[model samples]
Target: MGTLFRRKSRMVVVDFLPLPPVESKRLNKAISETGFCSRREADRFIEAGQVRVNGAVAGLGVKVTPDDKIEVNGEMISKEVPKIYLAFHKPVGITCTTDTSKKDNIIDYINFPERIFPIGRLDKPSEGLIFMTNDGDIVNKILRAGNNHEKEYIVNVNRKITQAFIRQMSNGVPILDTVTKKCRVERINDFTFRIILTQGLNRQIRRMCKHLGYEVTRLKRMRIMNISLGKLKPGQYRHFSPKELQEINQLLANSIKTEEASEN
Candidate 1:
């Protein structure tokens, strides 16, 4: 027993090197990861002193360690991985809302196992590719009007499109108390045109066409950002490939990095 004790003491000798302290992450991220709200909204909560970590009021810029207890509005947040991202080609006549009050909302058409909300929006009368995700972080990155994510559309009008109308659209049109941003427009057929817009105003295409005295019969968005609706029929959806997800994440990362660098 004496020998064994001696051996254990010898093995337990402390090292001279100091151990690294555990780093703390921002409280906003912890709340946002729970899928409750976006990081921006989380910051608002933090500023309002509505969040508590380890029985202390969580202030803005306060860091949270792994073992720390977190509570929001007196409710404990479950640390679970966020839900998956998805994209769907919304069919015409389907509203982009989750409210059941709307009889023809997109939520009724989706058969996914998880609750996913549309990232942005496509008008009920317009059919095209729409991204749906539980990740609120990516929504601002993708939908910021200043981000200039190009949206390509094929629009069918009732009458033949004139060169003057194309020029006006490509230059800029007045709508929503603001001048529409410059866009790319090309004639596809006698009454069809393909237009690519970098700005998304509410019912922009319809309002623009209305200003030109032309009624849009159909408007289909073929692309958003770098994701194309290719071969994905209307009213159908598929999981984003690994490569596609990587590309989108990279785009968002770059945008955030750029913004941070500019601020610094």
Candidate 2:
């Protein structure tokens, strides 16, 4: 397990590349793997002529070695440390932010021995399975539910559940500036229901409830894709198992995070 992390500082070193190396890192892949940005973003930057290698404009197909000086928008892109992926069951009232100044920020609450940040938000009033990772690039890949990843939630409403509400929620609810995509909503009890959403809108579920004239008394995320919030109490976390990580990698294998999907 010690091999997974380096005892030295978080700063990583880039080794010198051998001359005429058999293989070199592709510009987009190198930038994405460095956790600087998504590969989609890297490609866009290259297209916009914002990327440079050895002080020359780098195209999309350009390759880089350790000897190459890669820059974006005039700032050099450097090597990155290894990434960490964590699953956390956050308690209500903990803010999902990296800003340590926030009194109840999730970062300060978890206080992992190393630097890490929550992948997506669970909101201050809600709780449950939220991913914490040091890889910024993977954030878009996971959160872009347009790729068909599912996020399940259990909600308790202020009023008794109704078939009409379930049908409407399952069909779709018009909120914000656009209608929400169709999702699975089923009743669990008089005032409780389970919902699986494929789109992450800003305060989506809450807004949908308000529009239906129902108030959410409690909300808890049960799962994100294949990862479950099982046996995890509030303010608790665990490293993803090998099986879990393997399945996730398979799921994200062909998924590329684009700007359009990230807006969701």
Judging by lDDT against the true structure, name the best candidate.
2
| Candidate 1: worst-modelled 10 consecutive residues by lDDT | 255-264
TM, every model: 0.75, 0.74
| Residue 256 Cα positional deviation in candidate 1, in Å, after optimal superposition | 4.9
Backbone-clash count (model 2): 0
Model 2 lDDT at residue 126? 93
TM-score of decoy 2: 0.74
lDDT, candidate 1, 135-199, per-residue tens: 65676778766777778999999988999999998999898799988999999999999999877
Clashing pairs in 2: none
Runs in model 1 deviating more than 4 A are 1-28, 36-77, 100-102, 256-264
lDDT at 260 for candidate 1? Answer: 12
